[model samples]
Target: MAEKLPALAFGELTDVVRFLMEIDKLKSIQRRTKVLGTDRQENTAEHSWHFAVAVMALAPYAGDQVDIFKVLKMAVIHDIVEIDAGDVLVYDLVARQAIHSEEEAAAIRLFGMLPDAQGKEFHHLWHEYEAGESAEAQFALMIDRLMPVLMNLHNQGQSWVENGIRLEQVLSRNAFIADVYPALWDHLKNHLDKAHQSGWLK
Candidate 1:
C-alpha cells in the first residue's frame, strides 16, 4: 500500500511563484561593472552571486567577528531593489542619491511579492545592508565597494577610462572601504596605484 499525494496548495504556491518570476528580472538588469577577465558587462544577478562568493571567501578576514550567514543573506538580497530601481553607477553620486528614496520604495514592493514573513525578513537584510551599521553590514558593504575596484584594476580601468573618471573620484567613492576594512582597503589602494601608474586609471 502506497501513500497518496496531497492536493497542491495553489494560492500559496502562486504567490511564491510570482515572487520568483519577478526576481528573474535581476538577470537582465545590467550593471556598470563588467565581468572580470571578460569583455561582457555584468548583470545584477551575477553581481549578487559574486558578492555572496566574495563573502564566503573573505569571511574570515572581516574586520570584526560577524554572523557570516547574515552577511551572506545581506549580499544576496541587497540588490533586489535593482529590479525596480536599477543599478546606479558608483561614480554617479547625484543619481545615486536620487534613487535612494525610490530604492526604499522598491524594496517594499519587491519583497512584498513574497509571503509576509519572508518579505519582512528580506526587507530587514536589505535595510540593514543599506544602513551599514552593524559588523556584518559593514563587512558586506566592504565587499560591495571592493569588487568594482578589483574589476576596474583587472580590466585596465575599463569603466573608469570609458567614463573619463579620475583617480580622485575613484578613491573618494571608495574611501569607506579603507575606513571600515583597512587591510582590504590597503590591498585595493596598492592595486589602484598600479592601475594609475600603468595608465589604466586616470
Candidate 2:
C-alpha cells in the first residue's frame, strides 16, 4: 500500500490563516509630518521598524537594567493597534484618552488574529507596553517619546505650531522620559529649549 499523509489539525490551520491575515493589517497605520514639509503618510510597519532600531541604538541608557530583547519586541509591535485605531497625535490629549478603549478593542481584534501562542505573546507585549510596568515598558515609553521629539525638532516644530501646542503641555507630556532615561531626556530638553527660543513653541 502507498504511504498515507497524516491529517492536519484544525487549530493549526486556523493559526496559519490568522498569521497571514494579521500581516496585511500592518500597512494600515498612517502618520503625516507637518513639521518636515512632507505631507506623505507613514505606515505603521515603518514606524515600528524605526522605533525598534531606536530601542537598539539607545538600549545602553535604559532604566533599571532592562532586557533589550523584550524592549525590542515591545517597540516593534507597540503601535500595531494603530492599524485599526489610527494614529492619535500626542498633542491631542482629550482625543487620545477618548480613544483608549477603542484602541484596546483594536488590540484584541488584531492580536487575536495570530496563532494562539503567537497571539497571546503579542497581546501580552501590547498590554505590557500599555501598563508601562517593567523596565522594558519604561524604555519602550521613552523611545515612544523620543522619536516624535526628534522629528519635531528636525522640522522646526511644525506639528506643534500647526496644532497650537503649548510649551507647558509638551513639557508635561514628555517629562516622564527623564525618570526612565535621563540622557535621552537631556538631549531632548536641549532641543526643546532651542525650539522655544526660536518661536517654535508659541
Please list the residue runs of candidate 1 whose C-alpha ends up more than 4 Å from where it truly belongs after superposition: 1-11
lDDT of 2 at 46: 78
RMSD of 1: 5.7
lDDT of 1 by residue, 12-69 (tens): 6777878888899999998887887787889999999999999999987874569999
lDDT string, candidate 2, 1-202, tens digits = 9999864446658666755666677776666444256766567677788799998898767644799999998987788788778888887889899999988998888878776788899999999999998888988988887787787788877778777777888889999988886776787878888899998897
Specify the highest-lDDT model's number: 1
Positional deviation of 137 in candidate 1, in angstroms? 0.9
**Residue 101, candidate 2: alpha-carbon lDDT:** 94
